[model samples]
Target: MREVAAAAGVSRQTVSRVLNDHPSIRPDTRERVLAAMAELNFRPNRAARMLTTARSRTIGVLAASASSLFGPASSLDAVENAAREAGYFVTVAHVSGPEVAAVEAALDHLMAQAVEGIVVIAPQQRVQDAMAAVSLQVPSVTLHGAGLAGDDGVFVDQVEGARLATRHLLATGHRRIAHLCGPGDWSETRARRDGFLEEIAAGGEDVTGIVSREGDWTAESGAAIGAELLADPELTAIFSSNDQMALGVLHAAREAGRRVPEDLAVVGFDDIPEAAYFAPPLTTVKQDFAELGRRCVARLVERIEGVGAVGGGGGAGSATGSATDSAAAPVPPQLVVRASA
Candidate 1:
């Protein structure tokens, strides 16, 4: 405070007021002190600051897994950025091993750190079950729509994204479309499959039952399922639950000598970075993981600030943004039509 005052040529009291964000300080004088502090890269000791104001300005993130897939990882980043901008420090714990035990350990670690709040970023049913077991010791929010079905959650509109992809297939005259769904434990997998099934039924076509195979959201798993789909002769179009799997499907199609869009088209969800450069330029639904991160932070901040969550009181809207807010929020997955589809 003294050094800032000396550098800015202001009184020590003025610098103190500026540092504390006192309303009594003149705007110009505060600006000078702040600029001087910035030039010196002066960061106030958080512990000292907290002594005066009982705020730790810290948040904890508990992730079921460290996999940076489109939803969980992206939302974690968004939450981190949001918390940082709001003047909060972040600590993250990546849970591993058995789902329930890992989550409990992660939460316990965060509790020891005394984080003001916590945000969970995993999408597994087991993760949700673990959260329920914890009873939310601190103000906590789940970024994915797991555990808190009736309560608001931050999630992408998976159902809408699936509808977009499946409707595109139907529009292209694909009647025998098959869905390569993700693991049954994920809420997104269920939502996406339901949306695809609903769209198929609404089209008034006799629904060819979804020839499904479970995957843990990996390209290898997709490839394994793709190989199986290739052996079946009647399948015309395939929508893998995610882009990684879609790429696997494309690989399998190439090996089987089937041409994309001519013999069998492919559509994938979560348009990952490399989807655009794939052999046939994968047609995929692009979801914003970064937005998920931001929402996580915002909601967590609300919990810390005692303002409650952003939407629906104590919770927020979908972490994946919404279908209608495509331009402004732009978190919903868009069908990036390409030669593959």
Candidate 2:
């Protein structure tokens, strides 16, 4: 504060007013302070400033796992940016594990700061179940939609994404298709598996020899399981639960003297940035995670500010800006066709 004030040739109080965006500060003076701040690369601590404000305007995020994972990590970045754009500060609390005690501890940490709202971005069932066991005072929402099924939840339609992948394989005439599933603990794993099964049954495909294998959402797990599933010569295609596993399956196919889209067709989920540059490229389901984040924040804000649901109520989230005024509905995923399938 002192450095910025000195650089801007203003008192510390004036600097404070600029930081707070007080209307009393003239535009030229505000510009001077901002330029000074830019030169000094100074950032005000919003949490510290919250003490003097009527509302802290902070949103808390309770993550059950490390933010390095693809799905939750991407959503976390999106949530932070969207929250900032909505004029709210974001505070994140990461749980060491999916225990009720951990969840309670994380909530307590956030509540200590008096966050106006909370977001749970981890997609694991254990995490959501643990969260459900605890009571919260502030408005809250989840991106996974695992435990919360109502209007308060926002998520990419995992089931529909799975159906898109499976339907593509089936329509391409891959009759003996196998499914590589993610670990059982995550809600997405179950939803995707259910979608694949639903499609197979709907297509009236014979379940006599079809198999579903579980992987740990890793390329190594995918490769090992892919090799095992491919051992059955009759299996002509594999729909992986995620892209990493699908990449692993590609390796397994190569080792088995099989070529993608020839000996076997492969489809994965998430359509990660690298999917398009894969060996044969990848046909996969693309989740609008950024849109999911925007919708989650919008839903939580609605509850916090009592603004009612976006687009009436219970509508699925769509891609847009100014999400607070848009629908907080479930974002749909699209199928990206590539050479893999």
Task: Tell me, by TM-score, which candidate is best.
Answer: 1
Candidate 2 clashing pairs?
315-329, 316-329, 316-330, 317-329, 317-330
In model 2, the worst 10-residue window by lDDT is 311-320
- Cα TM-score of candidate 1: 0.86
Q: Each candidate's root-mean-square deviation in Å? A: 4.8, 5.4
Q: Distance (Å) between predicted and true CA of 323, model 2?
A: 11
Per-residue lDDT over 48-67 for candidate 1, one digit per residue giving the tens place of the 0 to 100 score: 87787666778898887656
Question: Model 2, residue 180: displacement in angstroms?
Answer: 0.7
> What lDDT does the true structure give each of the candidates?
0.77, 0.82
- TM of each candidate vs. truth: 0.86, 0.82
Residue-level lDDT tens digits of model 2 in 1-341:
99999999999999989887789999999999999999999987775777676568899998886666688788889999899988898999999888899989988999898887888876777887787788777767777753234424677788888888889888887778888999888888888888888888877645422555679888899999999998989898899999999999999999999999888999999988999998899999998888888887877776666623332222122212444545555688899999999
